[model samples]
Target: MDGGLMLAESLPRTSSFATDRQRGGAAFVERWTNARAGVIGFLTGRGYSSCSIAERIDDRPETVRRMWTLWDLSAYGHDGRAPQVVVPLSQRDRAHLAGAAATAGLTIEAYCEQILVNSIRR
Candidate 1:
């Protein structure tokens, strides 16, 4: 098991979605620190779905999904400067790419972007 999963398992589980912001306007959302984002990315690499992550962190599944996307974008240097591009691959190739990305603790998009960046830098 990843160390992050172990630590996440020990987090206090909450049934309510209420927070300080709900009670008062003191806070709105939990700050996404580098460590927190990395943990989410790690869990994602382990094939945990967004719902699974949301349950673990006691947040909405949608929030987890958004955060995961944001983390991927930031980590891969995708500054939204370039428009999104789609690369269609065969089923076999897609599966292979996904497997490789999972092994490297990254999403398929992030893994592909990383490869592109590295190739450009070479």
Candidate 2:
């Protein structure tokens, strides 16, 4: 055999890691776009940027932006600036929710949104 080549050996295949890196680069672009949209939307609504929200929530700017995408609210004006809270409902509220859901032939969440929309319309 000469220094030129070896016919017995085939070239090595591409590494999955390399392919994944390429894919990750593209995915990063997509994720960044989503984050940008979310941050811009939040900024428009609350007069703040990703960093402001992150500081408010005790998270990093990028992390907060990622959360926006994860929550499926990366689009503009997706969610309000209200802080989310869990309230233990009284039996009365439960009954009211059930009745409203049944009346609308919708799930409890849908009924709640409907109620919220109506309340906000005022």
Candidate 3:
């Protein structure tokens, strides 16, 4: 045990262990860390697949799946969320949508949905 402890202590620690204050940017980290669960819940409630959530959050699907498992979100469909509508777009339009989504901190699917909904209002 002592030898194992000594070997572990000898290894270098990563910045991941750094505190929010130590990172000199607590706002982003704190906000996301606190809200991630709620965000995932919202997406799950909306019946979004893990892959879709991963695409929106710019994370790997496996990571999202692991999170879902850890969070005990298995109550949802095992096959994942149902498929959403698909809108064909040109390369230029796709780029524009991507930029808009990034600026709005939303995924392309979400941004497009919001746009479609707003258009219905008009």
Candidate number of the best TM-score: 3
> What is the Cα-based TM-score of model 3?
0.38
Can you give the lDDT of residue 100 in candidate 1? 100
Error of 1 at 21 (Å): 14
Worst-scoring 10-residue span by lDDT in model 1: 15-24
Task: Work out the TM-score per prediction.
Answer: 0.37, 0.37, 0.38
* Greater-TM-score candidate between 1 and 3: 3
Candidate 2 C-alpha lDDT tens digits along 29-87 = 22335444444454435445566655543447787656667767635544545422233
Residue 24 of model 3 has an lDDT of 52
Q: Give the TM-score ranking, best first.
A: 3, 1, 2
What's the C-alpha lDDT at position 65 in model 2?
A: 58
Per-residue alpha-carbon lDDT of model 3 for 12-71, expressed as tens digits?
A: 332232222324565445323534555556566555677666666556778777887776
Every candidate's lDDT: 0.64, 0.53, 0.61
Question: Model 1: per-residue lDDT, tens digit, 1-122?
Answer: 34324444565554443332232355554445454555556556555667766786566778877775755755764433353445657899999999999999999989999998899999
- What would you estimate as the lDDT of candidate 1? 0.64
